[model samples]
Target: MAITCGLVVANIYYNQPLLAEIGRTFRLSESEVSLVATITQVGYTLGLLFVVPLGDKRERKSLILVLILAAALCMAGAASAPSFVILAAASLCIGIFSAVPQLLMPMAASLASDEERGRVVGKVMSGLLIGILLSRTISGYVGAHFGWRTMFWAGAAVMVLLTGILAQMLPRNQPNFQGSYGGLLKSLVTLTRDLPVLRRSALVGTCMFAGFSAFWTTLVFFLESDTYRYGSDVAGLFGLIGATGAFAASFAGKSADRKGPDFGINLGILLFVGAYVLLAFGGYYLVGLVVSVVILDVGQQMTHISNQARIFSLLPEARSRLNTVYMTAAFLGASLGSLSGAWAWTHFHWPGVCGVGLAFGGMAYLLNRFYGRTASVIAPAL
Candidate 1:
């Protein structure tokens, strides 16, 4: 499950360093290459809207398998795109189908004891975090040697194998409701009505990820600029630093399962704040780059797994729909991050990107404060 999710989620980020390579191949500008991120986020947001709810209504195993197959097809299309337009369209498809792992995650969660679920999830999520960070490195090496298209091909092959593994290993899932699909859409609106549960989970998850999205969106710009003077390969290696956080995920997971999310979140905040401090230094000193990645990634992944662990406890039966809302908010932050990161890169450089991340962190902190006062959060029943 970890390998499957890690490889699939990696698709979202693999193009970070390759943006420069893509610019040269397509005779595009820096801003244009940045659109690749925008397009994918937009598509993923749509996927969160339409596909994630399937876990609540449809059978999860089949839904996951179908989505994986579709993702494979999308990767193949991305690999074979004849032009940037086609490539962008293909990326959209990849984003749309990448919701597969989201489906699989809660399915895995449901099977485990609550006491151990966070640990199990954290271990699996470590794979995902590593995958997200490493894909950039892998793509850099692969794109430099074989061309950017080769990364998509590699992604496609991974999806093919994951599909088979999932099909064989996952439990059979029966439908949850035979109701109209329209009702599913209707419930989405209800979920957004700021129920105490959604308030605590969706809002917190979204706000936290906003900072995460902000930092990651312009990471390539940071590396490629005069600040770092890094090529794709070096930018990619920066991804390895993030793997440190991945190694720590199971620890965070065990902590979450034992102590609950509050402790994990506080730790996450301190770590993220430290990450920005490190990056602020990185803006001046080149060596700070390495430390920043490890700190930031560890913080982000810890908060993420912890947040999901808390939210899932609220609505066990509706895990998929809950994830849909959580992730939708998460992607909204990402979309804002991508667009803002591009504008910041065009205008204020590394400080601007850091500023974006810090602002989101501030917003998340405010919300966290509000959450602290709420009856739900004061003594969260979960």
Candidate 2:
């Protein structure tokens, strides 16, 4: 399940490092090519809303299989797209169906014993975060050496293989919800409305992810500037540095399991803020950037794992819906961040992008500080 989650979720991130090449391919402006990342996140948000909730309403394995097939086909479409518009549309489809990881997460949570749930989710999330980080590394190298289309084609082939493996290896999970799909969807709102913990988790995740998206979406542009004069391969190499966080994810999860999630979450926010401080001052220094990447990724992973650990503990029967609400808000923030990052990059360059990231980090810290005390009550109820 961890391998599957990582492989499947990697699809949406392939475009982040390839935005420049993609722009050149279609004769697009920086702003226009940036939309590729923004639109993909938008599609992911939409899928989280319309698709992931079905994990509770339908047989999960079947739903996952169908989505995998759709993702593979969409990847093929993205590889063959003749125009920027067509490619963008294909990217949206890819994002929508690539929500398989979200399904797998709740399934993992449902199957684990209470004491082990956070560790299980953390282990899986470590895989997910590794996929997110390494996808850029792989895509950067592939997109630079071969071509962006080739990268998509490779991703499609991986999806085809994953489909078969998952079909055989995945255990059958009974549907948790006995209701209409509409009722399933309605329950998402009810879950969000009633659970203050859900609300707080979603808000914190949104802020962190917004900052994360802002940094990643504009990173290539920063590297390509006269100061760095680096290629996509160098941009991809940064993922290796960021992969340091994957280790922290497991640690954070275990910490959450022992010390409660809030401990890790508070530490994560502090690290996030510190990472931006490094970035803001480091300018184009390679050492500074590397340190920032490590801090930033670790911080993000810590908060992410802790948040999931907390949310999954609330209403076991509704893990998927809770995930739906949390991830939807998170990706919506990603879309916003991507869009804002593009605008910031175009108008104000690297400093502006860093400012946006720091601002997001600040907002997240404040929200957590103000509401976190009360929100702790929501997690232990289950």
By TM-score, who's the top model here? 2
Steric overlap count per candidate: 0, 0
Residue range with the least summed lDDT across 10 consecutive positions in model 2: 373-382
Taking all chains together, the TM-score of candidate 2 against the true structure is 0.97
> What shift in Å separates residue 314 of candidate 2 from its native position after superposition?
0.8
lDDT for 36 (candidate 1) = 88
Q: Candidate 2: which stretches are off by over 4 Å? A: 372-382
Highest lDDT among the candidates is held by which one?
A: 2
| Pairs with backbone N, CA or C atoms under 3 Å apart (clashes), candidate 1 | none
lDDT of 2 by residue, 1-382 (tens): 8899889999999999999999999999888999999989998888999999999989999999999999999999999999998999999999999999999999999999989888999999989999999999999999999999999999999999999998899999887788889888888877776788888899999999999999999999999999799988889889878999999989998999999999999999999989988998995899999999999999999998999999999898989989999999899989989998999999999999999999999999888778645543433221
lDDT of 1 by residue, 219-270 (tens): 7777777766777877777777678889778888899988988778768877
In candidate 1, where is summed lDDT lowest over 10 consecutive residues?
373-382
